[model samples]
Target: MDRPELPLAQLHAFLVLAEELHFGHAAERLGIAQPPLSQQIRRLEDKVGHALFARTPGRVDLTPAGRELLPAARRALAELADGLAAARAAGSGRTGRLRLGFAASLAFTVLPGLLHAHRERFPDVRLEIREMTTAPQLAALRERRIDAGLLREPPPDEPELKFMTVLSERFVAVLPAGHPLARHRTVEVAALADAPFVMLPRASGPGLHDRIVELCREAGFVPQVAQHAVEWQTVCALVEAGLGVSLAPAGIRRIRLKGVAFRAIEPGARTRVAVAWRADDTSPLVAGLLATMSEAGPTAAPPAARPAPR
Candidate 1:
């Protein structure tokens, strides 16, 4: 028979009948009345010009043609299934280029583990990592400029985004070695009520900086801001210069500033870093990155006051 004239539906019906060895059950699986299924089978047999099954009172067995075609049919279906699984996985960013966004600090620390695990599981996936702040990352995600983000918590007010809090890290107060609070076992957040501070850019990580401010407020007064340094490294450098104290997560300890000291903040002051993407976007690449990040989990922790909430 010419390929163009072949009835795929009948072939499918024939394959189902072979598996079930029963007309009614195969019909049920196909969601059609049994009579129609039987007619379809008859048509298929007519096309093949042969009887495909032996009909007995309680049993149905494959005839020569049926026996011959069964394995071929199954092999074809198996090929289709394998092809589809690979296509689906590839379509979902699991196989192709993936644009991943993160902060400068995250790139050296957690991003390494995330990239390692992500690529190991999906070796074919090409990774593009961009270092950007939480705000720009959010904008790029919304504009379809980036596939997914790994950053400190997003602006809490972004109703258009859905985020998951993956992991939380404790706050580490960075101070000059001789600073008054550096000698304590665990520095109380309250002790910094009047302390001058270095902070991340208020526009870029307002949610995080605000949480730090709120923590200070809970301790009794608004934190005194002496300088606003954007990057974690910048904050560490400023602290080393004895400009002011800075509060960051434990991850910041990786920076080896000569005169800076790191002490864990008491009462567990934390900044929440999350993975964010457009809640309604339907890109498979986005889903793939999300799956990767979901499997990657969160980086870390915090809560409290804000001038303009993020």
Candidate 2:
């Protein structure tokens, strides 16, 4: 047998008539004429295959079938309303998970502040944070593996991606606490021309590596890289171990490594950290995060805040 689908208009009319018990009053409540209301009730009874109301000359009352269906109809309407609300929330980015990729170096500096601010504004959003290097972060974004990336390297004319710089910091010299040059408040880049350098590998962050080399070359000599580490923190650790001195963003000085000292570099070398995502990504959750970043402005924490070593 074919099941009869309940029409909302007829169901609503039936419900109002059942509550009023008077055809004229129910018609008034429904903003329809009494004759039309009566006709709608009759059509509803035929579709339901049940006489749902007992009509008297002056009044009406629910039949057993109508009494039985009242609660079910109410529950169905409630569920429909709830479903619509959920759909709207999802569309507005009020709830969902955002996959975010960030450079490992930002873990101590920019990442925490950005996360905290975002969480405060959008508590229902789940931030799935990943620590990755520049190359992999860009690859993940291109593959749609991550919704957005916070990285030190800016894309080179990739038309499919859009980005903006979130923070810029002067490059400073990181050296062992006892290094002779550490005695000065600021070190000239030319002063370290012959010094051994502990650097992050090119594969880990090619843009940053190349930028440092370029800065050194501009200072009159190529840096002598004595060791390579996978992370900025590791590079700083090596400097603390007296392996060699290196150049790093000023914001990195916020990390409190006992044996390392950070000094301003003269004729400053600078680096910018940027956030990027696919130009075609139009998901509300991604848009929400982008809006939050835009509102939060540049997120460079003062170097005085000591972050735990990575």
Candidate 3:
């Protein structure tokens, strides 16, 4: 079966008249003269083979056909709006869903700003995120599950993924308030050379964990990694138990922990955080987030680690 052909100009005319309910008023709203508005509406009614509006000197009512076309007309205009919006967003580099993967720790920092800016500019877009270790983030990026990742510097000689070094987050010694280091305003990694440590899982972010160890090694001592864990909350919990101290990024302050004491490390030592994307996926979403981060600030500065609310 064939469907009736609908013209955009006709549809526009009908919609404007429908809204105004008066030929003169509709023309005024459309910024046109009354005669043309009337001619267009009449043409639409003739083509549709139905009188779309019932009229009298002082009364206006939508005929059954007009009533039915109203919803369709509204939908047509809405879709046109969405299409135009998608185009504008893409041109300004803010459209599309961004599948972002990040190391659990990176999410505590600048990534939030990237996401916030993306939302402010393209509220209609879908933003999906996943938290994983650098290894998984890299793998997911390769597999196309994520458009970009927040990760650390790549080891020497692998140039497949496009990456940019954004910031080198400083290492902060996180301790329980009662611990010895808590009393010091600033402590060096050398000071904790022989101290027990709660390490980020080697599988999750080995670069960061190893970098902390290397800092101690530079001080000529080895760190005693007493516990291995993937999440920051666990490290803080272990610290609260008086088990060991952990080195976390400046953003770690967002976690509110009763027993945790986070202090800046001496020598300005820190882990590098970078943004990476598949060299080919140039989706507007990925580009937009990075662009947003370039201009925006951090999302929410957490007070301290109190477990994520239930």
Candidate 4:
């Protein structure tokens, strides 16, 4: 005693014939013969267990059941059409969710412009942004906890990740506004050789932390660490507190702590910010974002050199 399935073709025929009220006209619109159209309507009527149309020699009209089914049939077809369109849009990367991770400092540099451009081009794509340091960003990318990451100095040897540098900036010295060196427009790396340094722990951003240490060593002395902070803002805050001096990417100058000053460094070293994703990721959402980044180009404006604090 199972009920029969209602075929879409029969439902479609029913709606068309219901509107035309004539098998000849409905069949013409459907590009089929009148006999087949009649057969489809009869099958649909059988499924609904009622007569859908009343016919005289020259007239056709809907029964009460047919009238009731009209609105529901129209709504069903409309909903199906909408669902198909949404699926196609998601497949083409025009509408979907992207979970993105970024270094906190990038909010001052490449991230804002990149995100704006992506949103402009794909307004329906939802972006979920997470602030993370380089190390954790990499780990998250590998764990698939994120779709992509904007990080500083991604390791070149990570075989499972793909990276593209989006920004490169020279190292700058961060010092207390009241420190004598802050008066100089440019400070040599060697000037801070014996000075205690406020630094990010190597664990937070190994590539950048190690590079700063190497730059100091090249200048003939290892930086003596006095304090550590996990974020650039905190490092700048510590420097402003006169805890110790530190070197950071020029982009860090954007933090603008009233008590902190940024100065160009000599024997210049540069750090890079890159976008990274799993090597195996083939999701169209990731591809779309990567394409947008490529179109935008790696033209993030470098931090303007700041005048000495008076």
* C-alpha TM-scores of all predictions: 0.67, 0.88, 0.68, 0.92
For residue 58, model 2's alpha carbon misses the true position, in angstroms, by 3.9
- How much RMSD separates candidate 1 from the native structure? 8.4
Tens digits of per-residue lDDT, candidate 4, 1-310, equal 8977778888888889888988899999999999999888888988899998998898899999999988888888888889999999999999999999999988988888899999998999999999999999999999999999998888878999999888877789998888989899889999998789999999988888888999999999999999999998999998888889999988888897899888888877788888999999999999999999888766644753577755
lDDT score for candidate 3 against the true structure? 0.76
Residues 1-310 of candidate 2 have per-residue lDDT tens digits of 9988888788888878888899989999999999988888889899888899987788788899989988877777778889998789889988889999999878866888889988998898889999899888889999999999998858587798899888876788898989988887778999998789999888877888889999998999999999998887888899999899999877778678989988887886668799999999989998888888898787654542233233
- Candidate 3's displacement at residue 3, Å, is 7.8
Q: Could you arrange the candidates by TM-score from highest to lowest?
A: 4, 2, 3, 1
RMSD of 4: 2.0
What TM-score number comes out for model 1? 0.67
Most TM-score-accurate candidate: 4
Name the runs in model 4 displaced over 4 angstroms: 1-3
Residue 223 shift from truth in candidate 2, angstroms? 2.0
Candidate 3 deviant stretches above 4 angstroms: 1-93, 153-157, 296-310
Error of 3 at 38 (Å): 20
- lDDT (tens digit, per residue) of candidate 1 on 10-102: 778889999999988889999999999888888878877888888898788899998997887777777878999989877765677778789
TM-score of 2: 0.88
Q: Between candidates 1 and 4, name the one with more favorable TM-score.
A: 4
lDDT of each: 0.78, 0.85, 0.76, 0.89
- Judged by whole-model lDDT over C-alpha atoms, candidate 4 comes out at 0.89
